[model samples]
Target: MPEFTYDMLVIGSGPAGQRAAIQAAKLGKRVAMAERRGVVGGACINTGTIPSKTLREAVLHLSGYRLRSLYGASYTVKQHITMEDLLFRTDHVVRHEIDVTLHQLMRNDVDLFNAHAQFVDPHTLRLIDLDKRGTRAMRHLSAATIVIAAGTEATRDEHIPFDGQRICSSDDVLQMQRLPHSLAVVGAGVIGLEYASLFAALGVRVTLIDKRQRLLSFIDAEIVDTLAHHLRENRVTLRLGEEVSGMEPFNDVSGDRVRIQLASGKQVVTDAALYSIGRTGATNDRGRISVNERYQTNVPHIYAVGDVIGFPSLASTSMEQGRLAACHAFGVEATSVPALFPYGVYSIPEISMVGRTEEELTAEGVPYEVGKAHYREIARGQIIGDTIGLLKLIFHLQTHALLGVHIIGDGASELIHIGQAVLSLNAPIEYFVNTVFNYPTLAECYKTAAFDGINRLGGVRQDAVATSSRN
Candidate 1:
């Protein structure tokens, strides 16, 4: 037997990496983790998820986007909310999160190396210390089992170079000194739309460009349509089906604007350009894991998970992927996940869904019925000044079982969990219809939608009426 030093070595200190390391350590295995940053918590807690979410919250509050209707457009004294306000909360939250994460790791006895790590072989990793005083300062390490959760990097396309002034990536948004009066966001994916929405809310004239015909093409079309309408209402322009041909930094244009020429023969002059389509596996450097089923690489001892592996690159799913990988690595069979999982887009008016989309159902030839409840019709939505939102429910025609739930509006992400639970349990539409939710709540929409779906199942409608009459 080859002498293995540590029982497990977790690469990356993000949510997935951290969870896997802690889980393995709890199983009485000596574990260690490699973190590129000087601090412990990975990009999720540090830059990407937490920072962006905090920025969105700050933008929502200061811009008075939430209270504009109630206060009659005079709510915001300062139309511009500074980056400091956004970064202040982000810095506080991330520091606390990192401190808590370090405490947890210390309690679990997981060694943390603040250096860049690469594969020496299948089982060995060479960690090079970033601080350079002399030539031979770094060290090498080996482990029995390795988990690759290095996450992903921003996709910097060849056409546009990020100079951090005229052009930048999502990471640069937080560190920006002055806010732009107008911005061009290339790529209408989650990251692109997120920043675009927040900036538009802050009164920056934004032009969003996407190569595809629609934004978030994989989501429920109705939900995407609603979100797009909201974005448009904020004065954000959509330039779909257009690609960037070239970009020139207009150094002569005062106040740092970028002149971009599009493939559609459109010239866009914006205060700055943000390229958000950059996404590639962080494991490209290590080359240890095969991007295969169960997230195992060529070396059986090494594994990969989260955004690095590709589709459904959500922080929520990424954490689960990490846990499942850990379970399989330790030879413990865990509960199998159902086909249905929730989707969340954290825009100003968020979007979330669970189970099959209407298009997917149609393509599969599955007979289904849909029931919709607009947020405007719901009391809670009116109370919160949210008039532009919708809840959609799909059900199997024969079985009256819940096939999917799609939501777009405030608290859509949180509200989708109830639908997720129902789908996971294989509950029928009647389950929600029979269950009475609290009055004047967003959740009541689910009940209303369920009733509508159940009624569409043909016999359920008569049966419900008969039962009601008997009662």
Candidate 2:
């Protein structure tokens, strides 16, 4: 019985929780993870990242968003797309993600428990099984170390009435039974913008409302401007620097509609509203726990990671945080997270960046030169009908060392990795200039941008070498 007790226990099966348990099991520790949902992959796989991205892909394909420019503005790949059409792909992807996560845990010999976990003490946890009807089964378990990767929940305010129909949260969007003709997105965060762009691509009139003057202020300003331009071109309305005062349901011939009143004495009526203002840590009543650099809570043996830790709550970063926490718990030395990691926003046309932004470098008084490569200049861009995409590279004016890479357009998320690799190695601009790349590919943009940067610095132009390459 003593041996059966877990050496490490992780609550929540998100990217963070899954990685934490796997890391602990890899260290030959008895590891177990408890998830409230019957599924293993937590919110990321079930509702947040995986499902939303899948839905976006489906919307893009069925709506003929990419082919619109070449085929004409009125052309649509599919005319009568329904909610089921979008959810079919999303459901399939989510199930596959959950299965993959389960397989990973099983192969690593990590025990899985389906229950809501609550701390009875520092080391002991009470697991309540709500799956059983009429009777709630409870089990108590003791672990040498505990990880609270419970993630976060979509915040709900009492002032707003969310019916999961007329007005819904981001999570509720996944469970929507039908698509609305028009939608008013009440937030302009990543999730809000992604959904707004997706729906707009599907021919829905989307109005994005936010109190802030800009969207995703953490991103490079130029990239944000490009995204804003694309959103406007797609016919998505922006209502920035305006606060929503209240909402009321109105009955119309088209069915139920939401009248959103703004603090600036304005009103907008839409078929539905998506309220995606923020999220709160799902750590039950205990809330977010404080952690040290090693991800250890004040109660030494306890740790927290992922969205529960707050800020930059990306699935990729969450996975790393979980692995690092496990390493620290087992006294294993782990490499610190890199100073620069890529951030991929899955909005229509996409946006990705790594390293420091131009704004940050300028504010820090770091001398840098900017190099840009528009997709129109790349052969593959025309082939794929993404001529509006742009890649910007920032490098040290003196050292020619790669400083930042920002991209906004189709496949921007995929293309940013090349820049990330160069940045991680602290490689100089000449690396890209001298390196041979496959012709007629988006990857060639790096070479072009590098040459453009070198030329701006008055270095010898390598344009002849790049131009002479075979496609």
Cα RMSD (Å) between model 2 and the true structure? Answer: 2.2
lDDT of 1 by residue, 42-64 (tens): 77887789888888887887788
Model 1 Cα RMSD, 1 decimal: 2.7
Candidate 2: regions farther than 4 A off: 1-4, 132-134, 461-471
TM-score of each: 0.94, 0.96
Identify the runs in model 1 with alpha carbons over 4 angstroms from their true place. Answer: 132-136, 284-289, 336-338, 455-471
- The best candidate by lDDT is 2
Candidate 1: residue 335 Cα off by (Å): 3.1
Ten consecutive residues with minimal summed lDDT in candidate 1? 462-471
Q: How many steric clashes does model 2 contain? A: 0
Error of 1 at 221 (Å): 1.1
Checking candidate 2 for backbone clashes, the offending pairs are none
Prediction RMSDs, each to the true structure: 2.7, 2.2
| 201-276: candidate 2 lDDT, tens digit per residue | 8888999999999999889999999889988988899999999999978998878899999999999999999999
